[model samples]
Target: MRITVWDLPLRLFHWLLAAAVAGALITINLGVSWIEWHARFGLAVVGLIAFRLVWGVVGSTHSRFASFVPTPSAVASYVRGHWRQPGHNPLGALSVYAMLGLFGFQAVSGLFTTDEIAFSGPLTRAVSSDLVATLSRLHRQTEWWLYLLLGLHVLSIIVYRLRGIKLVGPMIHGRKEVDQTVPQPRGGGVLAFIIAVGIAAAAVWLANGSWIPVPPPAPAPAW
Candidate 1:
């Protein structure tokens, strides 16, 4: 019963990322004028992903990959029966990794995609048209998988809620019921904020095309 489940920063990151992703989906589905917001939301996803990669290394115990990444045998064992752990169980851990990897892929690919018009990725021109087309296709295709993963995630949460577990409340409040004997984790909230803000700023810079300098066109041929 005694277990530290989630760090505050990790919880906030989850909910905020969820909101941003939802906003991006809405804006993209709307069309035209909303592209700017959509692009910005995509950038935020990139930043959050970057921060998460770093956090996975130095974050709180429960927030680190080592804490949840079970071996095949361990996962098999979990699948066969109950884990009953305070932190993420084997299936939950797999979902975590899947979400992180998919989001990371989607965000990175978005940077090379274009609307096939005046609006294009900041670095799209830096790469080849073939690559751009590939990235664009990938960006479009990944949305469906993201939706599937999100649907499963929500369904799992609903199941937990029906079973009398307030999973959403813990995510929002950053607290959960465990044992008094087990100590709560010490987190890097301030550090996490700084990293998130810095990454977001960098994302904005890239999204606004500040990094990719334009090259001069070739000189006209002699008459």
Candidate 2:
């Protein structure tokens, strides 16, 4: 009954995304000087999701979709109490994928959007104004789905916790015990973190357009 729950990369990505999302939320709400940081954090989130997508393809057996994602009938049966799982189950995997997809969409859209004032995404100028407007609208509208997905994720965790599930522990430790057997993980946590960081940095660099410092506007002539 034992199973490798989450790869170390996935676990760290989970927590780091949580923290970055929190920071983005706070900075956005705080306004003023924080919006810049919010954009920066969102960029980081996009990178994290990108790394995850790549990892899902190249990662360990337990981390790959071939291992966890199940069919609709299987997910339903699990919900109906007809089936039990040792790892991500079925419904949870779908939710995970949904969150990743939605968030990635949100972040990518933001990059081509403009604040409708002076601040523009690094690539915003590359697109037509009409396209920028659409991307901006999409980016803003996607917030609802992001909020809904986040709520569901939290609710699922709460339900599992109430059911005496140590879900968070396994994420942190990358191991779980089921039916007297201790589960072993597939990837090394440290290696995963290093890889994740490198991927994130590359994504951010690309998004920022080489991080070439944007020069300030020239001062207005004296009256």
* Root-mean-square deviation of every model: 2.8, 3.7
lDDT of 1 by residue, 56-173 (tens): 7667867877878777976887888655556777888888899989987887788888988756876787889999999999899999999999999999999989988777887776
Q: Output the lDDT of residue 221, model 1.
A: 100
For candidate 1, give the lDDT of residue 139: 92
lDDT of 2 at 173: 81
Tell me the deviation in Å of residue 29 in model 1: 0.5
**Clashes per model (N, Cα, C within 3 A):** 0, 0
Task: Give the poorly placed runs of model 1, Cα more than 4 Å off.
Answer: 1-4, 80-82, 187-208, 217-223
Task: Point out where model 2 deviates above 4 Å.
Answer: 1-4, 180-199, 211-223
Best by TM-score: 1
Residue 7, candidate 2: Cα error in Å is 2.4
**Per-residue lDDT of candidate 2, residues 138-176 (tens digit):** 988888888888998889889999999877888898777
Q: CA shift at 144, candidate 2, in angstroms?
A: 2.1
